[model samples]
Target chain A: MISTASAVIGSRVSVGHRMLALTWLISPLLLLATWALVAASGHYSAQLLIPPADVWHTFKDLLHSGELLEGAAFSLRRLASGFVLGASGGLLFGAALALSKTVEVYCAPMFHVLRQVPSIALIPMFILVFGVEETFKVLLVTKAVFFPVALATSEGIKAIPRSHFEVARLYRLPRYSLLLDVVFPAAAPPILTGLRVGLTRAWMVLVAAELLAADSGLGQMIEMGRQMMRIDVVMVGVITIGLIGFVLDSSLRLLERRLFRWKAIKE
Target chain B: MNASLDQRWLASTSHSPGALQIRELSKHYLLDGQPMEVLKGIDLRVKPGEFVSIVGASGCGKSSLLRLIAGLESDYSGDMQLDGKAITTTSLERGIVFQDHRLFPWKTVAQNIAIALKRSPLTRQEKALRVAEHIRLVNLQGFENAYPHQLSGGMAQRAAIARALITQPKLLLLDEPFGALDALTRISMQRELQRIWVQHRSTMIMVTHDVEEALYLGDRVIVMDARPGRIKYEIDVDLPHPRERHAPRLQELKEILLTELAGSDADK
Candidate 1:
């Protein structure tokens, strides 16, 4: 069996198992080097052209003052509440749409139309209805998460091969057992991918919503930095946001690999 | 070993391997509002512990016939029964393997085979033991943890066969179970299937386009014709288990079957 696997997925294990390659750092280093060169070249004013070192100093100050942690915690808390509720709701709704002809016929067109309207465009109405507080930000995040996750779940369930259901019937698997043993496993890959996509998109929307109006968040910190003319503080917020988003997405991708290791088996 | 439980399973399996009886079985489908007949008034009988093979050209509905027996479809008008029980919905007594090895991709080989026992009366320990036993039966001991895609085509098919049989079903249906294989793998799997049949002695019915495969494994071969499918010929192999592949008798029968099949093809 190992031989057969090796024959199909030859030598990829070596490349795939590494956590990080030295080559991955080169691009980031190059970007930083270019930024430093520009800062030293002295084209822009000191305010506009603060060096990477100044951003690092700002990063340290935020870290030491606990502002960064507080802001990050607040942002993440909102994401968690919104994502959990939205994703679970989407999962249930998507499953219903996939499993029931009634749901598909009645709800699919409206779902398609609603998902097309971007969450950012709904902010003014959302502000009026839900107010420019935590409710507004979380709802925007939930909206961002719901549509893609539901779409993915519905399509994923529909994509499961009919023959699998036949086999389930042949063995007379009970309804719940059929769902657990066959249906869920087949649809899991796509559903997980949808979650990753939703979470990242929600993060983007939540940040934008915070920038528009929020008491405390990473996005609000960036907004404050702009008002205070602290370019270094703005850079700190920007870098943290980018790094956090990358970490969230990368971690989910890793989780997907770990969960679906069997998928590596070639057909 | 649980001697009494093992004895019960053996007795239930060998003493009364299900007998399949079919009569006036015909199936049709509505193709864009037109009723298209796929099988026409077919009749077949499979005795207990019998290995029956059905062969036909495309559109012969040999597969549909097997699916009907497996109770995968119910729209057909017919008398179909296993051991005097009228077939209605899918039953655990009738297990099927398709041309594709339908081992769940997410499952390991052991897990795949074990799923067949989800509704079995066996205790968890007995189910595990039986799964291991079937793994051995299919010569897949070392591959038990391997996923389907990790297996070679032949290995995957053997795993599928193991899954089909682990239920201790009265009748196992194979719809071109080896049609996806290369020549070498096909021959080896046929030998493996024959050996398993000799050991388990459960009733099996296989459908294949390969006349040689049908003749090699089957105690009796039923040739079918296409376009409103009907059984055209039945040839009994008057041979024993572990029949020699290169035997003069098999070769002779193959010649006759091929000539009849060629004649039917010429008419097309």
Candidate 2:
């Protein structure tokens, strides 16, 4: 009886341990096979629905010609610049709002209204204002990134328990250390969630901005491909943008897991 | 070990004033435009190196009294002193361990303990040593890297106790520190606390509802009554440290405290 119970527990543990890796590949592999089969069945024209082989070839050609690599690098550079500017500003502004009632009362309503305006919807307005240049793209992406991070940061700071603040006061923790040690660490999990949301949204906004107007970048590549009726190239750009965004999000999640190991294993 | 009880505590070494003093302390909360009194005209004194446990029925403001002493509540009208200084706000010299282990869930037990020492002037090595010592003092030596959620109820409370003690506070205020623990764990923790009190001999005031616990640990037990809470009775244990679980004197005190709490409940 004891051995049967032990066997049950051991099998459950083994299955649970391997679940993540197994789940990761299962759906994507299934989708790839289904796509390959549907394309082979010739239900749609190749132009309208390229086969997996055609997409793969276009991907290889772009990589070999270094177009894909350089295009992605430029897009990444824009993302990095805009995200840094927006996220940092958002962090500071959010903390200020949390700490000062005047800032909250003054800026909160305006910020709320502004955030409701989609960054994509502002593309034409931004183009007219900034002349379809890199400034327009960066500023649009910044708008996309800023609000979520700021709102999350303020909410995170506010959510910290009164007990922790009392402990901080008892220890005579100074302003700088109080922020660095108590406030930051306590607020970090929620802040990281905010950062993750901001990052994905910014990536989407960058692609959208490039779609509207840009000399280069993955979204521009797709836009140019669409205008010229090079559907395979458009497909390549779409897949690359998606893959990069997925990778960035997954990496942030990895960092969150490492930083909050104590919270992770509990769930 | 027996003689150490009579020896002066190194922390409050010679000529130290009272551990704590409260003079006519009262608190009123504005509830729905009505002034609700919590603590009323309470005067108490705790000598240096003494242990006191407070027991009362629910709503007796026992926890509020501890919070007042720990400087968590400052809006009260009273004179509260620690080491002969006025208590206006929280100070490291006065530490508190709550009923729930308030260790940051993201930090390990060691990190949680070390956080309390961040403002201290101790060196990195000294800080690590003090954390390790306190972890060991709470009998949590092997679980330094364990998170609070990973620990059992008893262990988490012990870690909380360790964090409170790491500062070497002049007075430690505990509000039902073991109230959440299961029966077996509570007994073990009481023994552990007794051992630690014998070793450190710092002034500790614990608020509890357990009759046995108040009798076992306190040098003096203060029983409180509700409806604008004030002390109804005080019992001196007059026993040495590392007290036995089944001491006759403690059992007698337990009956007296149980009667007091029951009597107050009956009145309500």
Candidate 3:
């Protein structure tokens, strides 16, 4: 009986591991297969319905020519710089609003109203102000990253129980120690989630800004491919954009797990 | 060995250090824009190394009184003094344990206890040693690295107790510290707490709703009445430490206290 139980448990563990590994590949494989079958049916126009092989060939061509890498690097640099500026500002502003009643009362209404104005909606005004240049694209990305981060940070801070602060007071912990030991850890999970959402939003806005008006970038590359009627090139650009976004999101999730390992153990 | 080290350290410092004196202490709160009295004319004296247990029904202001004593609440009327000093704000000399344990969920047991020592003048090594000792004092040595969520309710409350006592507070205030535990765990914890009290001899005040608990561990059990809460009567157990749970005296006192508590309910 013991042997059978051990055998069952061992097999179950291996099955669980297999399922986890399969999850990462399942969706992409299914999508690829569906695309290939649709292209092979010849029911649609070939110009619009490029096969998986053609898209793969185009991806390789772009990689060998270094256009994809250059566009990706430029887009990433803009994303990094803009995300850093917007997220830092959002964190500080959100914490200030949470901590100071006066700041919250005075600025919260305005912040809420302004955050409702979507980043894409402000593109025309931003283009007019900063011109069709790096500034316009970076600013658009920053605006995209800012609101979600700020809202998340403020909400996270507010959600911390008053008991935590009371405990801090009981110990008479210094300001820095209270913040470091109590406030930050208590507020971190939500803030990290906000950062993740901000990062993805920033990437989407940056791509849209580039597609609308830019001399270079992955979005511009796709736009150029569309103008030139090279559907395969556009497909490659789309796939690359998706892959990069996935990588960025996954890296942030890894960081969240590392920092909040305690949360995982609880579950 | 570590226990003796802790005992020696505690002995070297002033023993039986805290003496709490309350003079007609009353507190009011704004309830829907109208002032509501919670505690009314509460006067009590606790000598150094005394264990006082307060029992009352819910909304009896027993918790508010404990909060006031811990200096977590400062808007109350009347005077409260600890060691001849006025109680205004929280001091390291007074530590509190709430019923819910209130351990920082993200921190391990060791980290939670060590964080309480942040404001202490002790060196880092001494703080670490003291944390280990207190963890041992609570009989939670192997669970040092466990998070609060990983602990059972009784274990988490034990960790909370260690955190409260880590600063060597002269006065330790517990507000329903064992109210959330199961009957079996609660009994065990009461015994554990009694053992610790006998060993350390700190001035401790615990507010509980359990008459048996108050009678079991307290040197003096004070019964309170609610609705503008005030002390109704006090019972001196006149018993020594490590008293038997099934003692005839305790059974007799429990019956008396239960009757008094029932009378208060009837009056309410």
Q: Of the candidates shown, which would achieve the greatest TM-score relative to the real structure?
A: 3
Per-residue error at A119 for model 3, in Å? 0.9
TM-scores of the candidates in the order shown:
0.92, 0.90, 0.94
The global C-alpha lDDT for each of the candidates, from Candidate 1 onward, is: 0.90, 0.86, 0.91
Weakest ten-residue segment in model 3 chain B by summed lDDT: B8-17
Docking class of 3: medium
Which pairs in model 3 have colliding backbones?
Answer: none
The fraction of correct interface contacts reproduced by each prediction comes to: 0.81, 0.65, 0.77
Checking candidate 1 for backbone clashes, the offending pairs are none
What are the per-residue Cα lDDT tens digits for candidate 1 across A1-267? 989998667657656656355678889999999999999999988798799998999899999999999999999999999999889889989988998999999999999999999988988899999998888888888889999999999999999999999989888898888888998789999999999999999999888888889989999999999999998999998899999999999999999988898886545
Docking class of 1: medium
TM-score, cand. 1 vs. native: 0.92
lDDT of 3 by residue, A41-116 (tens): 9998899999999999999999999999999999999999899988988888888888789999999999999999
CA shift at B124, candidate 2, in angstroms?
A: 2.1
lDDT tens readout by residue for model 2, B49-118: 8889999888989999998888788899979988779999888888888889888787899998898888
Instruction: Give the residue spans of candidate 1 off by over 4 A.
Output: A1-20, A265-267, B1-15
Where's the lowest-lDDT run of ten residues in candidate 1 chain B?
B8-17
- Residue-level lDDT tens digits of model 1 in B8-106: 555533423789999999999999999999999999999999999998888899999988998989888989999999999898888888899998999
- Return the candidate ranking by lDDT, descending: 3, 1, 2
